[model samples]
Target chain A: MAEVRVENVSRSFGAHKALDDVSIAFPDGGFYALLGPSGSGKTTLLRQIAGFDFPDSGRIVIDGKGVERVPVEKRRIGMVFQNYALFPNMSVTDNVAFGLSVRGVSRAEIAGEVQRALDLVQLGGLGERRPHQLSGGQRQRVALARAIVIRPQVLLLDEPLSALDKALRVDMQVELKRIQREVGITTIFVTHDQEEALTMSDRIGILREGRLVQEGSPEEIYDHPVSEFAATFLGDANILRGEATETGIRLGDGTEIATRLNSMVRMTGKVSCAVRPERITILPASAAASTTGNRLAGRVSKRIFAGDSSTYFVERDGQTIKVLVQNAGQIPFDEGQDIVLTWSPESTVLIRT
Target chain B: MTSAQAARKGIRPALPLLAPAYLWLTVAIFLPLSAMAFFSFMTDLPMAGREWSLTLKNYAAFFSTSLYLTLLWSSLRLGLEVTAWCLVIGFPAAYVLAKVLKGRAREAIFLLVILPFWSNGLVRIFSWAMVLREGGILDTALNAVLPFTVSIDLMYSYPAVIIGLVHSYVPYMVLTCYLTLQAIDDSLIEAARSLGASRRQVLRRLILPLAMPGIVAGAVLIFVPVVGSFMEPRILGGRTGTFYGTVIEDQFVAVFNWPLGAALSFILLAVVLLILAASAPILRRAQQ
Candidate 1:
């Protein structure tokens, strides 16, 4: 396993810059996720690390050695594509043994390694089948086995689980995490799905428009997104426009919300308040008077029961904000009913607009 | 009505839609072929403008003649060579056209590749004759720099026939291979590269295997035409122009032996069918 370091990498096609001055270092034996939407340079970055593409202006080092001149095969990086591009002509055993065979390993060793790789992916007895005979999940596992069988320095997966159905995707995600841990290979997984990134990654690097917007643990990304884009992209957030003052910012409806601000930050500026849906609590009118912190009087515009939880669309000051309440008991309110939305000072994050 | 009767009624109304093309094929193709087969079994008229009789003399004569057998073998050999050459040159050109060029550039290149086929075959052969003859354009171009005499007589030879056949059939081979290569998903190569296969490995393992169907189809197309071709060898092969096609033409024109010509034509058809049948299983396996 090798640590991968990308320094000031930039790539462009004509006028469209796919990656621009992006730099990141992945430590040895950790799962790093490059999380971003489509056209956000996640795949480009992964391809560069795999030595499939060269950066226009930067250097990449694997295990403290510069790999700019090394060819893809010599770099010894294994990659799993999104489509699980297994060789249709080869059986599963031959597909997994392709790398070893190309590198001139002995036939006896190849047979043993192929079987071990197949067994690692939970497909011990399926070496004779073609890719078309396998399901989407099975094909993806075959692709994974083929990638890791040679014990590459780095393992790169470009949205590998995106092709499977939801149930299969979840199962494969758990399997992938287990396999990665077992192998202890430095892996870089590129995915746009926040849930997948959060679940599988040791550290998630959220990218936007070819730039790293935030890099942190899943909880940090969820609870402490530094920008409006980061907060909105990671999860649904109710954004309230406000202004910063000595005590707190005044909402558009002239309601004063008490908030704690960093002392270093100036108070004379426009700010936005972000709150998660589940963080806001809906209370009865009798309990509204006793509530503290930020409270707003609103009417339930729409209430939807989504199996395990009930979602309330509360309209406050001409803005509809969503509040998710667990369906442990009866719903707190019905559609078009008046209710008080309450949240603690800590729940509302003050972000610069 | 009964259910069976209702179903028969439903089927009866749509049968006319399939009739016209089948009738045309039967009358235009199968009927003539059957007539030719029947005539091949008949004896040729002893004198000009005479009548026909039931005899296997034509077939017997074709197998008995050493000259005719040699010509048949030579034609089949030339056909194989032309097909092999077309494939060797056409596959890479088609690959470049389909995978490297894009948009209007690809279309432009394809058009250029196919442009030779748009001209009449007689005109194309005459043009090649001009280039291959002594003191022709090719000789003149070579003589400009070389001190030695560049005018060698190249017009009437086996090489000339093979060259003409390849030139005529290369575009068809390229088109077949291009369509096959174009249909292959590029992601397959990308996947191979990401899996640590080099560029040469990608071409050998992914491209050649996937394009095998088109290669086989092109080979069949080029081989069938070159083997049965009379015009190229007649114009280009002067003394060496004694191919199976020339003999078939001779029986019809010079000898006025329709029965013998028909028998020779049937033999050639059988040879082509045999080759196709022999290759089908191999091609099918390659595709799988």
Candidate 2:
């Protein structure tokens, strides 16, 4: 296992810049996720790390060595493609043994290593079946086993679980995390699903328009997004645009809202504050006189009753403020009912407009 | 209705759609085959001017004659050699066309590969004869480039026959192999490379196995025809061309023994069927 670093990488295809000055340090034994929407260059950076594509101008350092010019076979990096890419001609045993056999390992050694890898993926007795005979999730396990059996310096996964159905995807997510921990290989996975990044990685780097937008722990980026794009993209955040004040911002209706003091964005003439939906509490309008912190009076425009929690859309001065409240057997507020939305200042993040 | 009856009803509509093609095939292929099989059992043609009797002498002659067996063995060998050459020359061309060349260039080259079919097969054989003869284009070109005098006469030989057959049929190999190679996902190749497989290893382990269907399909197409091809051998091989097909032609045309010819043709059909049956399992597995 080794720390992989991308320093000032930029790549372009024709006139389109796929990755621009992107840099991230994936630490040793840490699970890192490159999260982004389509066309955000997340897959580009993964390919660069895997040595499938060279960066136009940058250095990719793996295990304290510069390997920008190294070919994929020489890189000793195992990659699992989005489609799993299991060789259809080979049985499960041969598929897992491919890396070792190609490297000229002995037959006895390959047999043992392939068995061990298959067992690691919890497919111990399924060595004789071909790829078409196996289920989709089983194919994924075979692909993973095939990659890791070579004992690569780092494991690269390009949206490997994206092909699975929802239930299987969640199961594989936990299963994948277990395998990564068991093997302790420094791994980087690319995903567009923010929840997968949040649930799986120790660190997340969100990309936008071929640029790195934010890189930090999932909790850190989630709680304190630096820009409006990051705020809305990573999770649901009610954004309020207004004039900047000493603490937070004043809404266009002249209502003052307090924000966290340690926000990354500097207070300026114009700024926006991102308040998470779950952080706000919805109460009757008559009860607003007793509460403290940032508060707004609005009618509940809509209420969505989920199993564990409920989301209330409150319209205040022509702007809808979303408030999430846990379902605790209390009578839910109806639409068109007057309500007050209140949250602590620490829950609000001041984002650069 | 019962499910079986329902299934029969479901097929009823498609029968109208399928009739014309099946009828054409029965008339064009099966009727002649049936007639030949019947004639192979007779001693002579059943015409008003001749007395004919049902006999197994036609088939008996095929097994009793060592010359016929030798010719059949030689024909099978010819088929094997031509198919091997086509595979050697065609598979790489297919790989380059499918994977290396891009959109417009790939299409243009593919057109060139199949362009041999636009002209007549006889024209193609004659053209190869012109190229391979003693003082033809090949000989002249080699003599012009050489530092010493070389005879360079390859016409009227086994090699010339193999060359003509391979040239006439290589496009089938390339077309079949190209389709299967193109259908292979690019990521599978990338995945193999990432697993530390070199280019040669990828070809041997992944590509060749995955393309078995196309290779088998191409082999069947080229081999079946090349084994039965009397024209190219007659045009190119001269005296060396007397294989099973030429002997069969002699029985019908030169020797005027239609019953023996029918028996020989049926034997050839049986041999071809046996080969196809042997490869059917491999082709089916490859497709899966």
Candidate 3:
């Protein structure tokens, strides 16, 4: 419903800085995820946008209005905590109706709104049950329903699906995306799970050590990570360190691996190229290599079969390269067998560090 | 079988482990209560060279006498007043201890709250006497600050008795309420605030409802004792302290009528039990 922008926000607790000069804009009606490891300030940034805590220096604007100093209750932001935090003393109906009742909505209107909100979350007839009576997934729905029923300007979720089991978490992720789309509210989701962020958000901001390391579409960041940390943290990547050359980088073993040298990197000194595991094709060493792509000949030291795909750990010049091959009725490669790995120049991202 | 039934059966193996506590209760509590019940139905104490017989005269006397009933009513009123004051003063103190203060500061303040228990109850009551009596510490402090001279004679008054009882029992309220308040998750408060509930609304709608068990517990702890309290009223109330407890004490020590004293004590116990039974539903609901 509204664009929320955090600009140059810095917050400190005693000697430790929780958030350091972090800024990210959540566009109107867009689902943005703040992803980071623990203590990386993703939750801190979310709290700042929610107005739970004020930044030492910065401005938080909602709908073009300065609101960094406004208290949480008046900011019109709804948050679902990691634990769901449903009021155990009240039934599900009262829990969803809490926001409307607090704002002094009419009694009849509150009832209608609560029912609609519950139905939106696909929990239509669970109004009479207490929080303790509901299952883990049901409580999550009630928590979501409670937040969005108030029609907040922005919805903030802090690791909302972390409490559910894996299967339930996957189901709720889809359900959550559907509800957000249906409501058409700008939502800021904070999570440490990289897969959840990549699968759920329109734009993902990766944070580390109180700084925004990368922010872009999930595919953009995945395809072109600026640094080794971004490449490795966002997904699995095999980094090959080498000396930069005109066309590519020459590895320590005197083998030149081709790279496109995108604008993010310059070929003048030592560099690293990140190749995704799934992007590399594994071929028997006896077969002829492809005419125009980076290739590495190595022996398969280990192979992991995970139902539908296999991950082969290839050893070349004392460095391990991983290649993911889908299980498609081809005879699996055995350990200690020689293989040639090939990936296109565009799939290999060159990084300066 | 249902889990509850399974659980009940599971407790059977531990029944032997519970014997010592049950034995201690039987010897220390139940036996004395049974003796008292027997004495309340007697015509007189069967002492050396004394006559005794079973009779309903003790029960008849209690029902027929207006003075006894009136004093019982007044004692119940006193208990209610003392409990109300303790709650009004202790709940906020508990909230501060549980939610506001943290770390060593919280521990230090909590020590201060329960510090009264470290001293003897009589000593604490007598200390209040020193503060409330005319020309006492409070009087001197007030007279030193006020522009006009006024007598600060609060001793031997109803408010003096109420104040003394509340002081002696407020820690019970604070300790009980603090335990429950501290168990509330901080995120619940944040969730309520994020939902546009003001501070006052959060307290009323969330905190109060969640802490009801503690309030009910503290009220029981304070009310039951204050109803039968003779020391606080006798020490603080002076001539105005002629409630059911003092009268029962008089029958035993001054009148030398054991039968009447025992009868009076039984009636008081019955009244307390009736009140507790009446509020059992509310207490059960609060726990849920």
Candidate 4:
């Protein structure tokens, strides 16, 4: 039940800075996800928090104690690696008991606690089996059980479900969330998968090029992304670069898209606007004869039929605009059919850059 | 296909490929072993114009003679000591080469560790004689650094034999251990540390067990050969190196007791087999 606060942490490899002046405070008992692309320094920041690697500058405070210089063994952090890293020489029970055994727990108590941990992970009857004998998902659960056995102040997971297949990954994600809620440990998970981050974490910090570009709850971030990178990277967003006006941005084709966000932007300069794909509704031009909020007319270039939903790619002024619509029992708008795209002004996000 | 036909089909391609190697082993190993067994049961070598007969006398002689039994124990202890020293020195060297060093530096240093194996074993052992003999390199070096005269005579001693054997076989330990140690994932160590395992705990609980196969392989390679070794003991041990191996050598080279020597050799082979069988389960677990 400890909170981890990374303060002004900066680390560099030679002249290339991997993490630069990043500061973030994780609330106690919160499931936080450090989401980023490869080489974006999410793993580096996680390592700094875990004490696997030290930051060249700045302090790391865990549970109100500055421990940037402390080694991992003394920091009392449990970690589940990407590959699980279950000790091959040990059986499933032994792997789970490792942390407690290292802390000099009694044998009778270790056996009981190990069994309880295994039961907690729902691996009740698999004590004697080696790590190689278990399935990928089973190994992941054992890893989780092992990390929580000693009841560390904080738990770190480095791409915990990345090695599992799609179905198992989803299953494990739900299971992971349930276990973390049960333990109520301050857990920090690092991953490159955006869906995993969005679905599993209470709070997410999106990083880009060694800097924290955005940090908020999933709903907060999804509904309002400040930068163009966050807008496109977190989810599908249509971006239009044009001249800023009192209403919004005027496109090259003289189409003015209204943006509802207004706090931090220039009054009269070039600006960009972002609109999510799912927020827009597409209708055939023959049936689209209404004046509403933020309307645009374009020809449908392509339509993809996924089982429950279909994405329509519409071409408007040399740009392809993507719109996701739920599939009703009707044929989608055909190719070369003129369509009108409409979304409320609340769905439109104004980007400062 | 039916089960019998499928089994036949699987064997058809493999039999031809496996025949040459098995045939070579039968000719080179089994035939000689059979011949040695036959000679061990004989009272004398069936040389030209010599009387010979089958007897259990050589085996009886080995059991009845205390010198032979004592020397056998001595040779076994020598093998154990040498294997222990090799492991003590070699495992850390292997770990450094495999984990600590990286890139081309690892490759170059690993080659340097294995470079001695490229030279002749006899020459290497004899070179140790130069270092261990009275008033030799070691004595001279120690004397030059001290204010008093020093008599560092280590030649013709049991420790000299162990030193020479360890020098000749430590590379085997380093090579085998390096292969397995390098395959250990770096993340396992970090995972252990994250679970609050100290450095010694991680090494004992994770690394030593994981590298057990390589350690066993290196032990078998060094111990089996050192148990039957005559040259290393003779070259470096001189007079005090009168081990069971040297006694076996004497039967063929000096004593003219071929049947007895073959019987002794068979007994040593039995001891080596027993040691291997004792450690087989451990080796199997390490491999898994």
Whole-model Cα lDDT of every candidate shown, in order: 0.87, 0.93, 0.92, 0.91
Docking outcome class, model 1? medium
Estimate, for each residue in A1-353, the C-alpha lDDT of model 3 and write its tens digit.
89999999999999999989988899999999998899999999998888889999999999999999999999999899999999989999999999999999999999999999999998999999999999999999999999999999999999999999999999999999999999999999999998999999999999998999999999999998988988999999999999998877899989998887577436678899899999999888888754579888899999999989999999999999988999999999999998888889889888878
Quick one: how many clashes does candidate 2 have? 0
Query: What's model 2's lDDT at A204?
Result: 96
Candidate maximizing DockQ: 3
- B1-288 per-residue lDDT for model 2 (tens digits): 798988878887788899999999999999998998999999999889988999999999988979888998999999999999999999999999999999899989989998999999899999989999999999899989999878778999999999989999999999999989998999999999999999999998889888888998899999998888899899999988889999899889999889999999999999999988997887787654
Clashes of 3: 0
How would the docking of model 2 be graded? Answer: medium
Tens digits of per-residue lDDT for model 3 on B1-288? 898988878988787999899999999999988888898889888899988999889878988979999999999999999999999999999999999999999999999998999999899889999999999988988999999877778899888899999999999999999999999999999999999999999999999989998999999999998998898899999999778888899888999888889989998998999999999998887655
lDDT of 3 at B45: 89
Candidates ranked by DockQ, best first? Answer: 3, 4, 2, 1
Off by over 4 Å in 4: A265-268, A286-290, B1-8, B279-288
Report how far residue B52 has shifted in candidate 1, in Å: 3.0
Q: DockQ: which is higher, 2 or 4? A: 4
lDDT of 4 by residue, B1-288 (tens): 798988877887788889999999999999999998999999888889889998999999999879999999999999999999999999999999999999999989989898998999888988898999999999999999999999879998888999999998999999999999999999999999999999999999899989988999899999999998999888878888889999999998999998999999999999889989988987787655
Error of 1 at A220 (Å): 1.0
lDDT of 4 by residue, A1-353 (tens): 89899999999999999999999999999999999999999999999998999999999999999999999999989899999999988999989999989899999999999999999999999999999999999999999999999998999999999999999999999999999999999999999998998999999999998999999999988889988988888888999888898888788888888888577645578878899999998867766466588988999999898999999899998999999989887777898998889898889888877
lDDT string for model 1 (B51-99, tens) is 7689988888877879888999999998989989999999999999989
Over 4 Å off, model 3: A265-267, B1-11, B147-150, B282-288
Error of 1 at B2 (Å): 25
